[model samples]
Target chain A: MSIITENNDIEDIKIEGEYDGIIELDQWFDPKAENSVLLILNQRIKLDHSAFEALWNSYTIKICADGAANRLFDYYRDSDGKRYHPDVIAGDMDSIREDVLEYYEAIETTTVIKQNTQYSTDFTKSVNVATLLLLGIDLNAVEINEYDGIHKLYQQADKSQLKDIPLLILNGIDGRFDHTIHSMVQFYALRRQDPYFKMCFLTMSDMIILIPSSKKGYWLKLDKVKPLIGNCGLLPLAGPNIITKTKGLKWDVEDWPTSIESGNVSSSNRFVGENCLIACEESIVMSVELKWDKITQHLIDESE
Target chain B: MSIITENNDIEDIKIEGEYDGIIELDQWFDPKAENSVLLILNQRIKLDHSAFEALWNSYTIKICADGAANRLFDYYRDSDGKRYHPDVIAGDMDSIREDVLEYYEAIETTTVIKQNTQYSTDFTKSVNVATLLLLGIDLNAVEINEYDGIHKLYQQADKSQLKDIPLLILNGIDGRFDHTIHSMVQFYALRRQDPYFKMCFLTMSDMIILIPSSKKGYWLKLDKVKPLIGNCGLLPLAGPNIITKTKGLKWDVEDWPTSIESGNVSSSNRFVGENCLIACEESIVMSVELKWDKITQHLIDESE
Candidate 1:
């Protein structure tokens, strides 16, 4: 289910998948529907069966980031239930159980094994897999799937097709602190690679992510942001840098200097109303609060 | 019922309280008894009650930070439960429920209410209580009851009575991202306020906090550490500020310039063997894995 609320010609579109909640639907939030493809990571932080099912049902092309396939299978164990598996289960087989691996293969969930690479974490491998899948490259044709082949995998993969696809990374943050930071690093890294690639991080409570560039007409609108002043932050994760200009917060900034691990940080800031505006020089992650129930209803209403 | 281990020197240490398993203890992780008090935050993170109870029953004094008192009361509904109501409940009372206030008052737990004070968060108020409690001050006195009268309470309290008592801070991290970050910010803020206030943050899975000064010769003996190589990271949170470090992990350095937001970071690093020596010029929050079972046993065994 998709919630596309159009005010002035596609102002905001909220996609309702398996997860339920009222998400922020704004121009700054939407990904280009044309080029990019959705990629699901192996880590599952606060995801249940229903939400996982939504992502499974919505996207036609899915790739599991290593042990994520195992987590998905283990979390939902109804053998006769609506078993929606990913299109490809690829990663190092360290955490992936043998039984789980065979189960997916038996059900035709293509398992791509990349055994010999330790330098790159499972997440990077998953990104490589998504790159290859988006490029429409056949994995069977590749003779060796080694760590060295990963750089080539990205090179041979279609880079142009990566833009504009709504990539929903699951269980990235809110698990291991290191992993969460790694996910944020990937956010900035990917933004540099494909500015049009639509990305949203689905944590247990809310969707936390980065906005690439600050433009004059950029604004964010949402439906009923209750608990409006819980805990929201604008982190300059890109190191000792400052952010200028903003609207819709108790401590809104105007060209104020901020940076991660140092400098002025905007924390314990309150969201004033249903709509907000934030403009930054480089992409910075903005964490917001939303109820999952509202998110589901918004999508249903939009699709209707 | 505290754990008195074979190697432990002290006794009568207790963790008598009802709590979720979200609060954990591992002897192999935290063997040091630096701060005597454990300040619990009200945030709804994964709390390991059993571990906390073990710690509380052993310690002579315990205090709850605002909503944390509510969480304790909620977790330990059974009156006969070993966990006692905290010695004091301190905070702004903006978030603490009215019913919770009445219940704790009936139980005779002292409530130090701080109103019209945005200068500090609730967690800080709780920390102040712990500090006052450690000094052996009776909080009920007229002079001590006032908001800024914390100094009066501390001055009258005996410092020699609880000189080496270590403070274990629970539910600080691992909740919402912003709150967790705010807790860290508090750590920096407090370190500046008083460099001698020894504190340790007990996160859900492991310990992620700072060692005020390396002066006490704080070193992790490897034989005391299990789950040795989990996803660990040591970043200079107050960066633009570089950190000087010594010993342990793959990237061992003395004054390494570490602040890699997008590219390089000390991630997937391991605790190489029997002991790790680390010291920072400024206070640094170090996230380390814990062997819960061992720590729990240590907490219980030490009280024996």
Candidate 2:
């Protein structure tokens, strides 16, 4: 099965929609996928059990960045929740409450790793931790004191066996501006390191994914991802691009030249078809609105 | 006083910490500057009155993007509010409640503009509207049925008399991933069209500003920006760049290269000095933590 469909129309570079490279965003929750991982950042735990169950049901290796463990602690305490312990809690030990740390540490299955190095953020550290854990490394065997300790481990591992995997990040995209952009930068950076690993930064309403410049032709399966509210955008975060041809958008662009300085951007465009087609000369950031009512409709949707 | 300081060290184009080009972020609230304007987006109104008052004290023209009028309406109803009426309510007329629209329209100064055009976001339209009003054009004087209506008016006006102005945007930075990124794009776009205008996207906790590439050497007076919790970040949102040299960050990099694809980024860095010096080869986004205790300690701190 081919993963790309090439085209030459729409005043720039156009491609026909194909099912080969279908970005099935909803498939991240598959329990059978061993490559899938879940990482949480510090945003208040606001979703219902079903909201979490949808994410938790994925049954992936779970990790939290510092104080996110506190949020998880509170959510379990405040609601009639299925207490899901994270595989690892990692960060500078700044925001995580003492009581919460003790609670998660008491669990034999959960490991607490504190890296106080300020060179990278707790987020970058947590992401590094998740990537290594997914690579089948025993973090408990290593003494991780540096911010990039886990990162160094990943560098020495055999990447030859890895397949393209999904790292679903929760409550990570909508907080501080720098945190949000950094998340995107890491996506680009991580992909550069190992093309088999990609991240999906999620909030209750949307998910952010990158269509790497190396892969010019793309098909985004957003109907199941967003349903009726298919509000989407193709952000030129990596650099300027002369031809960004897209299909199935409410305001589809023919040959939009986008630059941060020139101000040619496509934000707030809605997905109008079952799938959207995108082709660009450079890497672009894509975000789509998410609807979980259907996902959790029958699967224990907790009313918050 | 020259706005740029030149330096030849740091393994890249370096700059001295000059008093010029000092971006005093605190001055947006001055009632004396006619160019300073306030714009509200569709985030829930959660700040204390002092929070709004700090922004309102800047006392520039106030306008809300579509449904933000509803949030302003609800905040007034739910809190110990002064009920500062917005001068204009503008957008696609979808999210704004009928009652809220009528409420603001009843006031003599407030105008309700319905521009259902999808080419631009309501934030973009509201910004266009703000820029026009700042340029001394009465919005009420024009028939604006299209998204770029206000933009057209500005293109026809005299630009020689205007000075570089500040547009303080509230509840905009942290939203949908695209919304957050789009706000930054407009800043770059607006600056491209008129070098005399700039925007500051403010949250209760932080503010985002662009250090334009055109000006290579710049000094950011961030002592007042972030007091004790000096959490800050310089994002490479516009494109790839080399040598984003800085002097005031806790882990300042020397001649660092930043790109979305390269994963080389500066996030979760903090200020350790009174002022931060920056010299970038291309446009980079900067965000800093905000401390309002000093601004609101005595100025009516309405706790939410």
- Model number with the top DockQ: 2
Q: For residues A1-304, write the lDDT of model 2, one tens digit per residue.
A: 1121223322222336342355666655443466677888888876777668667766467889999998888776435644678999998889999888888888999999888777667877787777788777888887764555765775677777777677878876767767777778777777766667667876766778877653345777653344435567888888887545566666777556877667777776776666667777776778877665665563343222
**For all the predictions, what are the DockQ values?**
0.26, 0.67
Question: lDDT tens string, model 1, A17-131?
Answer: 2221122443112322443344556555355445455445555467777787777776765757635477677667687778877787787447565645776677767766666
Tell me the TM-score of each prediction against the true structure: 0.80, 0.85
Worst 10 residues of 2 chain A by lDDT: A1-10
Best by TM-score: 2
**What digit string (tens of lDDT, one per residue) describes model 2 on residues B1-304?**
1122233322221236343365765555442465677888998876776657666665568889999998888876435644668888888879999888777887888888888777667876787777677777777786864655665675677777777677778887666767777788777777766677667887766778888663346777543334424468878877878644676666666567877777776776776666667777776788876565664553333222
Query: lDDT by residue for model 1 over B1-304, one digit each (tens)?
Result: 2111122222232222331111122332343454456677876635456666667765555677777877776776555653357777777777678887787787755554553356556776676677776555566754554455564454455554443345667777656666666666666676654444555677655567564444222464444344333546665554422345544455555555554344455655655544455555554556665556666666565555
- Quote the lDDT for A211 in model 1: 58
What share of the reference contacts is kept in model 1?
0.23
